[model samples]
Target: MTSIRRRLLLSLFGLWITVWAAVALTTLDRSGHEVGELMDAQMAQLARVLREISLTDPQPAAKATPQALSAVGHPYESKLSYQRWLGDRLVASFGVAPVTPLAATIGFSDQEFGGARWRVFGLPGNAPDEVLFVAQSDTIREELIHFLTIQALKPILWSLPVSVLLMWLAVGEGLRPLYRLARSIGRRSAERLEPIDGDGVPAEIRPLTAALNDLMERLDQALAAERRFAADASHELRTPFAIIRTYAQIARRSGDPAERQAALDNLIRGVDRASRLISQLLILARLQGEPRATGRGVASLVRAAARVVADWQTDAQAAALTLTAAAAEGEPGVVAVPAAALGILIGNLVENGLKYTPPGGWVQVAIGSGRGSVALRVTDSGPGIPAADRERVFDRFYRPPGQAQPGSGLGLAIVRRICDLYGLRIEIRDGADGVGLSVLVIFPEPSGSPKAHPP
Candidate 1:
């Protein structure tokens, strides 16, 4: 597993080392340049002093000691060399004097002598042909530059451990709040869905905590919906179960064959009602957990409505209701919903319309496409719902007052859930001529059609 702290520390250390290395190299270069300039100035100053002394004494001692060339008790004293000449002949020599004649050129110049490279300064003596040369070995100058560079870089080396410790402390302090938040969340139980306290949270971490709190809130809502579903399912199932048992008992105890047959028929109806209620409840439960549709599945609204109308035509005929399906001027576009979900949505709307309409009433399923949207309309010539109870009918198990038709009250609720998942718009209003109910559903643009035909 990767660690944030470790990666942060590694990145910081890498940057720190890179900067230090650059500084060290710059310091070394600057130190070498400055020291070389200073050493060259010293060589010029030594030549001037030697010139004055040679002019002061026209005649000098034949034997010259090595110490005469430079100051005693100095670390680089032995590396110094000098040559004095008069009338094109060597007069005195000291230290590692070269055997060959020194260059006649004046000022400082690099010359190879005494089997070593030297920085030499040439000066004219008092006599026309007289000259003085003072020189230092290249190795001595390099050693001096190396020593000064080390001294200049010593502070950075000494401060490294202290700086690293401070950096580690700062990084740890910066991440302490995140660690605390993790611990706080880890301590929470599944049953405890209270919002996390954001009072002391850092501004950088506020977004993370806010998102987590939002997720917890959604989870809490889902759990509540599940609980309500459980309670409502049990309550609604109890009535049908009791009714079925009573009918079965009556059928068993009745003496007349006609009475027995009636009880048996009622028991069969009760079982069917119970089964339909269970199926609708299961569908609602499945849809409750889906927050949104994938929008990849596509289905034709016209086709789905036609299929639903066809499936219920027999029932409509038996009830003396006029059931018909039609499409508008254009072929209805595909909708971004699964074929099964489309079937359920249209099936529920058609069933609900037929259930409420009276004998000889007409129920219509219309499909149309316009303005990049698909509209599915289910209208019935039944007694219309009041404006006050229109929205309430979409709530599960909700039924308007004085309704004689038997229903689980979940059809419209299931329709609403599907519309919400697929981002469809639903509107309820009076039917044509203001006689009954009309539910208009607007579906968004089509994503695409499937390669295979929709089921």
Candidate 2:
């Protein structure tokens, strides 16, 4: 894995090194140019002085020979050379000066003699026939240029380690906030789901902390729901299991055949009720486990209701109840929820109505599509729920008092969960003629093609 600190440090270090090298090279070039100009000026001035000295000597031009100059105390004296020429005969010379003319030109020029390159300045002497040349070795000039260049760059070169140290410190200080944020998050326990402190947080990391806080909040809610579900399941299952066991014991001990048969029938009904409770618990758990909204496709509410009504036809007949489904002509009743979820929503309402309604009552599943909504209504001629208790009925494992029907109480709760997931609106009211319970679910008009169906 790549580290942010290391990448930043490397980039800064490379940039510093590049700048240092550039500055050093520029200094070297500039120093060399300035040194060459200064040396040329000095050589020219010396040649002019020599010409004046020869003019003031008051000596014959061809016979005037000055004393031979040698190195005094300076290290550069040996590298300097001069020649005095009267009509091509060498009259006087200095350290390492050759007998021949340095150059044909009367200005500064470079020449090679005595196996060494020289920068020579030539000038006209006092007499028209006299000439003077002053030269310095190219090697001495080059050595001086290099020495000056190094002296100019000394400070920059010496400060490299200090600059690197300061840069590292600055980069570390800039990244300290990120390290603090990481440590703060690391110190948290799983149950400590509170939002992270936004104070003093760097702007770059705020979004990440916000997202993490949201996830933790959602996880906390889901965990609380699961805990409630487990408690309710345990409490609700105890009664049915005890009833079945009691019935079994009665059947085993009864002497009369008729008594035994009655006990067996009760035992079967108890087993069926327990089985249904378990099924509803599992369904509720599965529904709760899913995300609030999923990748479900649009489906026809009318078609799903009709199918559910057909599936429950036999059960309705056995219970001595009439079950029917209807939809207006040209009304498709399209809804955004998936077909399978629609099935569960309609199935739960229908089952609730059928379970509560007495024999000889009728249960109706109606679909209606209006201007901006598709509505599903399940009405049953049963004992209607009180207005005060209707809202409470959606709570898990909450059965209204005076309810005689055997049920898991999770049916309406499941229905409510489904509606909430897909933004469906539901209402519980009295049936037609105010005789029984009616559940109306309003779905927002769908806009997509149908893709899913109930299993």
Computed on alpha carbons, the lDDT of every model, listed in order, comes to: 0.87, 0.86
Off by over 4 Å in 1: 56-75, 84-92, 101-118, 121-133, 244-268, 292-299, 311-320, 334-340, 369-373, 444-455
Instruction: Assess every candidate by TM-score.
Output: 0.82, 0.72
RMSD of each: 4.1, 5.5
lDDT of 2 by residue, 1-455 (tens): 99998999999989988988898889888988898999988888888888778766646445434345444668787789888887777877777866678889888888999899999888888777888889899988789888988888889888888988998899899898888878877887766767778898778888987887898788888988998899989999999999999999999999999999999999999999999899889889998988877336677887899889999999999999999998998677778788888988999999988888999999999988767888899999999999999999999989999987778889999999998888889999898898998899998885554434422
- Residue pairs that clash (backbone atoms under 3 angstroms), model 2: none
- Cα error of candidate 1 at position 434, Å: 2.6
As a whole number from 0 to 100, the lDDT of residue 139 in candidate 1 is: 88
Measured by lDDT, the strongest candidate is 1
Best by TM-score: 1
Superposition error at 323 for model 1 (Å): 3.0
Runs of candidate 2 with Cα error greater than 4 angstroms are: 18-157, 167-187, 294-296, 328-333, 370-372, 446-455
